[model samples]
Target: MKNLIAATYAPMHPDGSLNLGMIPSYTTFLQSNSIEGAFVNGSTGDFVSLSTLERKNLIAAWAKDKPKDFFLTNHVGHTNLNEAKELAAHSQGLVDAICVLPPFYFKPKTLESLLFYCAEVAKSAPDTPFYYYHIPVLTGADFNMLDFMKLAVEQVPNFTGIKYSQYNPTDFGKCLHFDQGSKNILFGVDEQLVDSLPLGATGWVGSTYNHLAPLYYKIISSYRNGDIEQAKLLQQKGVFFVQTLDKINGFNGAGKSFMRLFGLDMGPSRYPHKTMTDKQLALALKLMEPQEIAPLFNTSFSVKHLQAIG
Candidate 1:
């Protein structure tokens, strides 16, 4: 079975404060939906908009209540190297793994520079598995992972693999085959999952997994069962799911708000990320109805009951 890690949202209060109280129920929701893991504080979590202290508190809350058999990969990448290291150290004994993104503002001009940044952070958590976040569309440090992995294997003692979010199957394929497939390269593109299937993607981390785990696993099952057309059809529904969220407000905001329909209020997105009103959320759900996507949503957990226990 492929490991499906959901890139979780930073649950907040209506006042834009961290709602650490919501995490226990959040875990229940993911576990009930059959999500295998969580990739916290990554792009979907709005990491850049959060203060360093806030990020620390959020991950700590998650660590305190992690379910048995749940894999937590805390993303500790920051624009500031020292802060990133501090987060890495904080996560050392708390999470199953740690990952870092290249500094985006003064991005690494060469592969060596990026590897050096990863090395410094990896040293902070020497005992934990380390993964380099390769989302060049956001970081602008788009070095080929095939080349990155070659040197990373030789240099970074704890370097494990990458969270590949880009759309380069050729490079991803090569990396998957490198060293006769030792490293754990998790695919990060949700909609392009069907495409990565042929390349041997055994692990995936993405935001849509939060709401669509069953649909995605079905896509994989269909493919492995030699039903290629059914797999493609299901993957198209995944694409439609993203488009529906993107059309209403924006993906980050609307998607977070959409969680409420499943009984988990993710609160509002921070500045620059659009938030939808109750009316807008209704419209988003209605849009999903035509694609038959809305029927597949998970609504097994209750936030209110969880909060009462907490």
Candidate 2:
């Protein structure tokens, strides 16, 4: 509910098993660094590859130590309606909100079916806020903003926000139109927050934020304080960092390696997704060492001061 600068968790273990031990440390690390929330079992967390129980366990483990004000947005999306609903019920008290993407395989369909799918999860998690995860490119369901507006007013009163990941800025703005109050539009692409923020987005949900939270906070706060140039500079730096990772085969693998390098015990990404190679690691180290972005990992840097700069 509070303005969130959230990180998408990356489930990392050598055997593709969920490492429960690393979660507490990771939560503590985020809290210590002033992160407002986390999105567990999302794309960055490899939710598609995890079993039902694995996803539930990760959420429970994180809920145990998460700070009171630090919200958790559970990504409860799947082809199975029962599975998604059950997960929504399981996450009722644990998470602040439940985010569901349209059924992936049954896509390229009508808006009616998409709304029905979202409505099921929305009704299941009546108490928790429901945020639609609108990433059509990945799911094959192209949802327009006008349809979302219609649904929000009719079926789902708990429809509090949306995680719009598509690259279209105009469509993103259409999602922000609400007569009652401001809808929480969380930008899913980490690199585009600079452009997205001024358009009325209050929160961000992205994988890279797991390691780059400090920089993100800097950019968001700068923009909020009316320093667009400063925010743009920081956001540009973030895009450059993301572009560097783009050259690599996997972002999750590269992100975990970055976390490990900075001393977080987050292990290697699960199997099928290879860990960063020596060559890739060497390039990442070089790109991340520059002072402009290096402060992300520096313990001495104050998040408030970084927000105020420029």
Model 1, runs deviating above 4 Å: 299-310
lDDT by residue (tens digit), candidate 2, 34-114: 667888887777788789999999899888887777888899998899999999999999888999998898773888778
Highest lDDT scorer: 1
- Model 2 scores worst on lDDT over the 10 consecutive residues at 301-310
Clashes of 1: 0
Clashes of each: 0, 0
- lDDT values, one for every candidate: 0.89, 0.75
- Using TM-score as the measure, the top candidate is 1
What C-alpha lDDT, on a 0 to 100 scale, does residue 268 get in candidate 2?
A: 66
Question: If scored against the real structure, what TM-score would every candidate get?
Answer: 0.95, 0.88
